[model samples]
Structures are given as structure tokens and as C-alpha cells.
Target: MQPIGWVLLILAIILIIIIIKNFQIVPQSHAYVIERLGAYKTTWSTGLHLKIPFIERIAKRVSLKEQVVDFPPQPVITRDNVTMQIDTVVYFYITDPKLYAYGVENPIAAIENLTATTLRNIIGDLELDNTLTSRDVINTKIQVILDEATDAWGIKVKRVELKNILPPREIQAAMEKQMKAERERRAKILDAEGDKRSQILVSEGLKESAILKADAIKESKIREAQGEAEAIMTVQKAYADSLKMLNEASPTDKVIALKSLEAFEKAADGRATKIIIPSEIQSMATLAATLKEMVSDKNIDISPKSEQQAQTTETNS
Candidate 1:
């Protein structure tokens, strides 16, 4: 082959290589920053893009997907002068590829430094206790600060988290002891409350039992009184029934007198300080005694008269 033909073939090969190099395929969730003659030109999104070889070049390939960065532990001093190691995790994403490429020299290093500085500032304002307890507040403050600071760099700080906050070994031991003591105190209080509840329940049960016993005693007394009342009524009814039958029979005065005597005998059988007999009863008693004496004298005199009469009649005959 001739020298000019070989030179032409070499130029064609170089041109083909340049064209292939100029073609770019931006992948999903990715961006490409283009620079024209060392100056910012444009940003290419996810798709095929062409750039003039040797004139326009890709300055940076930015990933638009959310990313995570865990910074190393930083030594921080609290307001109370307690030193501790705190590590942070930041979640971020690229919002603008052009700005992220040209806005800062080392964006990741800038973010790490900013995070450290912000953490120190926040820790400086809080005591050890507050620093341990206020994780959410610290995280929110850091996120807000980082978002505002990184906005010009085309990065959006989605979230910031304190991954770990490690206190001194001595302080950790002391905290463990304090937590143990607090738990024991709570346990004692709970036990006391349980005992108090048990005592109250027992007292209530005893009170209820006493009330039931009193009610039972009261019911028994009421029943006993009712029984005595019924018995008295039965005795009175029997006496009334006997009196009614005697009246129905229409007894003579003598019989009534005898009944009265029987009633007086019954009254005498009972305990009494005095006994006052009625005038009718006194007259009946006196008549009974006089009749008894007259009958006795009649009997004695008849026997004697009969004997004397018999003797006198025989003498006269």
C-alpha cells in the first residue's frame, strides 16, 4: 500500500475511537456533569448523550439515588466538660449534578467536616445527661443544619442519626449502678403497693364477715320473738275456745261457781303477794260449810232418837 493510503486509514481508525469515546449512557438514578473547555456546560440525566471529543468532557458522574455515609467516631466535649466519642450516619442524595461537580472540591470530605463541627457545637451546648437522652433533638438539629449548608452543593440531607454515643468506662459503670438501684427502688415500691392492697382486701373481707354475722344474729332474735308471740297467741286462743264452749253448754250457777273455784285454785298455784276473793265466792264457801255441819248433826240425832222411841213403845205395850 501507498504511504498516503495507510495514513488515511490510520486517521479513520482514530476518528472511530474518538466518536465511540464521545458517546455516553447515563444509567438509572445517575447523572453526568459536562464541562466545556474546563467550564461548566450542562448536566445529562439518565439516557444516551453525546459530547464533543476533547472539547466537552464529563467532569463528574453523580448518583441521584439516596446514599448513606457513616462517619468515624468524633471526640466531643459536653457542656459539663465530659468527653465522649460520638459517631453519626448521614443519608443524602444529589439534587443537581452540575452544582455537586463544581460547587465544592471534595463534597464528601466537606460533609464529614461539617458533620463533625455541628456535632461538637451541639454537644457543647448540652450536658452529659442531656446528650445521652436527647438523641432525637440532636439528630433533627444536625439534619436541618446539614440540609441548609449543603443546599448550594446540590446535595439534600435527608436524615442524620447519631449512630453511637459512648461515654467513659467509669461513667458507664456508674450509670449501670444507678439504673440497678432505680430498678430495685421501683421493685420495693411495687411490693409495698401489693402488700397494701392485700391488707385492704383482707380488712374488707373481715368487715363483710362481721356484717353477715350481725345480720344473722339479728334475724335469729327476730325469729325467737316471733315464736314466743305465736305461742302466747295459741294459749290465749285455747282459753277463749274453752270459755266459748262452756257458754254454749249453758251451765248452772253452781257449775259456774265450781269453775270459779277452779280458776281461784289455779290463781293460788301461781306466785302472788295477796289473794282477794270476791263476795260471791265468799258466800258460796260459807253456805257449803253450813250445809256440811247440818247434815252431820241430823245423822247423829236420828240414830239416837230411833233407839229411844223403840224402847219406850215396848214398855207402853
Candidate 2:
């Protein structure tokens, strides 16, 4: 072939190659910033995209999906003048591709520097102990500051986190000791409270026992006094009733003597073996005279026949 024809053929092949390269297949969560005439232009959303051969170019590619980046440990000073090392992580994504590509020279470096400065500013206001403990607060503050700063760069900071806050070994040891001492103090207080309660219960029981004893003593005294009064009343009533019965007089003296003599004869009839009548029986008219004459001669003896005759004579008289 002629040289001119060969140059034309090569030119055609180069053009075809350029067109094929310009045909870009963007993923579901990605975007492409397009530039026209070496200046800022529009961005293409996800899917197949086309670009002008050389006049329009894909200057930058931005990811619409969230991305995670880890930061190395950084030394920070707290308000209490305590220094600690903190490791962090950040989640971010591009919302506006045009600004992300054209607004900042280096978007990632800018975002990282802004995050570090904001973290220092926020943490400087907190105490060392709080900074070590309050991860949620730190994360929220960091996210808010980062979002505000990165907005112009078309990056939205979804979240920020302090992965770890490491205090000095001496501070950690002191904290552990303080916690242990607090627990021991609580235990001692509880023990003292329990002991006091036990003592109070014992005292109450003793008091109750004493009250019961006193009550029993009081009741016994009342019962004894009542019994004494009842005994005195019973004795007095008996004496009064006996005096009233005695007030009703008996019969005449003759009748009393006769009944007394009859009772004495009946008693003696069952007890004595023999009886003797005095020779002067007519002289013995009173009971005392009769008794005295019958017993005056204790040695007098009589035969069984004489005793029987005397008994018959007495019966006849």
C-alpha cells in the first residue's frame, strides 16, 4: 500500500481504540467526574458512561458507598494535663462527585487533617478520666465537626469512633485500687449495719420478757389480796350465823337436867358392867347428889343376884 494510505489506516485504528477506552462501566455505588476543556464539569451517576475522546475527560472517580479508614494512635492532651494515646476510625462517602473531584486538591489528606484537629479541640476540654471513659461523647463530637468541615469537599462523614484510649500504667493501677477500696468500705458498712440490727432485736426480746414477768407478778399480787379478803369474809359470816342460832334460847332448867340425865344413863348403860344403888337414895334428890352418892363408895361389892335385885328395884322406883 502507499505511505499515505497506511497513515490513514493507523489513524483510524487509534481512533477506534480511544472510543473503546472511553466506554466506562461504572459499578452500582461509584461515580465519575467528567471535565470539559480541562475545566470543572458535571459528574455521571452509576452505570455505563461515555466520554469525549480527549476534549472531555474522566478527571476523578468517587465512591458513593460508605468507606472505612483506620487512623494510627495519636497523643492528645486533656484539660487536666493528662496525655493519652488514642486510635480512631472514620466512615465517610461522597455525596457530590463534582465538588469532591474539583474542590480539593487532595480530599483524603484534607479529611484526615481536619479530623485530627477537630478531635484535639474537643478532647482538650474534657478531663483525662472522662476522655478515657466517654467514647460515645467523643465519637459524636468528632462526627459533627468532621461533617461540617468536609461538607464543602462533597464528603459526608457518617460516623467517627475512638477505637481505643490508653492511659498510663500508673493511672490504671490507681483506678483499680480506688475501686477495690470503695468496695471494701461498702462491705464494712453493711456488716456494721447488720450487727446493729441484730443487737436491737435482742434488746427488744429482753424487754418483752421483762414486761411479761412484771405482768405475772402484778396478777399474782391481785389474786393473793382477793383470796385474803374472801377468807376473812367467810370467817365473819360463820361467826355471825352461829351467834344468830345461839340467840334462840333452850327450854327450862328442869327439862335440861332431865334430858341430860337420860342421855348420860343411855351412854352409861352401854359402857358399864354393873351399877350400885346407895342406901340413902331418898336423900339424894339432885343429879349432883345422886352421882356423888353412887360413886362415893368405890370399893363396895355386890353379888350377881343382889345386883339383879337392885336393878329391879330401881326400875320399879
Candidate 3:
């Protein structure tokens, strides 16, 4: 309630506010660059930090997390005097907050300019074709150079990528035409190979068919020959059996003569230009004619007595 007591309480409140403001808390993946008396002091990492209110101040707040920066397209000349525009992307992280805060006035701007200059130098050594094709080589070279150059600035270049390489319209058209022709050539080669393979398969199939046909023919001929052999054997066996049965039957001379006559008759029935009769068959026919004439004569007796006398004469002859 007194004036001095009120003034003392107000001063205590102001001091407390100032002290609390001086107690800084650095967050994760961040650092604080502290300067004492407008000179280099120390870097504060992620934790509670206290600084003198007017003498010690935070010069810069640096993020320790990886950062990506895409630089604008820079016009460059190749070894072949071809002009092109290429943009790049860089990945970096802060390593030392103190160096980053004091080493360069604008670190991002410095990196962009450095990247453009390095790109031009590298492109100057390569032809238009090599520059277009060798992306990995160019990226590695740029990353290495940037990492070394940015060491003093407390930055580490992790990766460098050529985001876009824009060539002239004419060059792009020519490349597309060349690629189309290459694809056509490969397609023709594949078609030719397929045709050749199909022909080989057809020829193989024909060869197999021919082989099977020949085998069938060979088998048919072999079977026909075997059948012919068996037929001949059967005919010969039948003829031999007939001869055996005939010999087993005992017959008189007249019966034998009749059988000979039957055989001669069978031989005469064929279409022969010439036929020769045996002398014995001719004599037997003459005797049969004489017997027939005697049987027809009226003076000759036709009884068994005459028949017996005729048979007795034939037997004696």
C-alpha cells in the first residue's frame, strides 16, 4: 500500500520478465548462433540456454535438418557450342551454426550462384550429347565440388540432381526420330527370327511325317510277304495230304485206269494251244471203244456169262 513498496514490486516484476525472456529454448533440429558484444560467442544446441540480455544476442537461428533448394535454370554452353538451359536441385544441411551465421551474408544466394557457375564449367567440358546423357556423372561432380566449397560456410551438400535439361527443339526432334528408327530395326530383327524359327518347326514336322509314312509302308510290305509265304505253305500241305490219302487206298487196274482218264479229262478242259496225250491213255480209250462196240452187237451175248468172258480176256492181257 505504500509508494516505495509498490515501486519495489513493479521493479521485481520487470526483472522477472527480462530474466524469463533471456532464457531461450532451442528446439529439435535447430541451433542458435549467439554473439556477445557484437562479436562471435558460441552456438547453442537444442536445450535450455541463457544469454545476457543486451550483451549476448541470438545472431541467427539455423535449422540442422536437411534442406532442399531448387535453383533457377541457368543458360550454359556445351563444348560443341550448343546453348541450353538447365535447372538443378541441391540437398544440404547445416553443420556449424557459428560458421553459417558469420561466414556468408546470404548462404542460399551464394549456393545458387556457385551452383550455376559449377554447372557452366562442367557443361563447357562436355558435348551436347554427353551433357544430355551423363546426368549421374555431372551430379556427382557438382555435389563434390559444392560440399568442399561450402565447408567454410558450415553447410554439407548431401546430393545434387539435374532437375531439367532443356535442349533445342531441333535436337529433341532428331533424337526422337533416331529412337523410332532403332525400335523399328529391333522389331524387324525379331520378326525375322520368328519366321526362321517357324520354318524350322515346319521342316521338322514334315521330316517326321515322311519318316512315319516310310515306316508304315515298310511294315505293310513285310506283312504282305509273310502272308504270301503262308499261302504257299498251305497250298503245298493240302496237295501233299491229298497224295497221301490217294496212296493209302488200294485199287484194281480198271479203277486205276478210270482215275487216269478223269485226270486226262480235267487236263483237256483247259485253254491250251496244244495238248499231248500219253500212249497208255490212248490205248485204254481204244480198248473202251472195242468193249462198247461188242456190247452193242446183237450176235454177242449181253449176259453175265459174256461179261465174265470179256473180263477174263482183259485180265489175261
Distance (Å) between predicted and true CA of 212, model 1? 2.1
Worst 10-residue lDDT window, candidate 3: 308-317
lDDT of 2 by residue, 1-317 (tens): 99999999999999999999989898888888888999877788878888888789888878888999898877888999888788889999988898888779998878778877888888899998788778899899999989998899889999998988877789878988999999999999999999999999999999999999999999999999999999999999998986565456556656556655565456344545455543333233696565544334333233323433432112211
Candidate RMSDs in Å, in order, are 12.7, 16.3, 10.4
- Model 1's lDDT to the true fold? 0.85
Give model 2's clash tally. Answer: 0
lDDT of 2 at 282: 28
Per-prediction TM-score to the true structure, in the order listed: 0.68, 0.54, 0.64
Assess the local accuracy of residue 219 in candidate 2 as a C-alpha lDDT between 0 and 100.
Answer: 99
Residue pairs with clashing backbones, model 1: none
- The candidate, 1 or 3, that scores higher on TM-score is 1
lDDT string, candidate 1, 140-248, tens digits: 9999999999999999999999999999999999999999999999999999999999999999999999999999999999999999999999999999999999999
The candidate scoring highest on TM-score is: 1
Error of 2 at 281 (Å): 55
lDDT preference between candidates 1 and 3, better one = 1
lDDT of each: 0.85, 0.78, 0.84
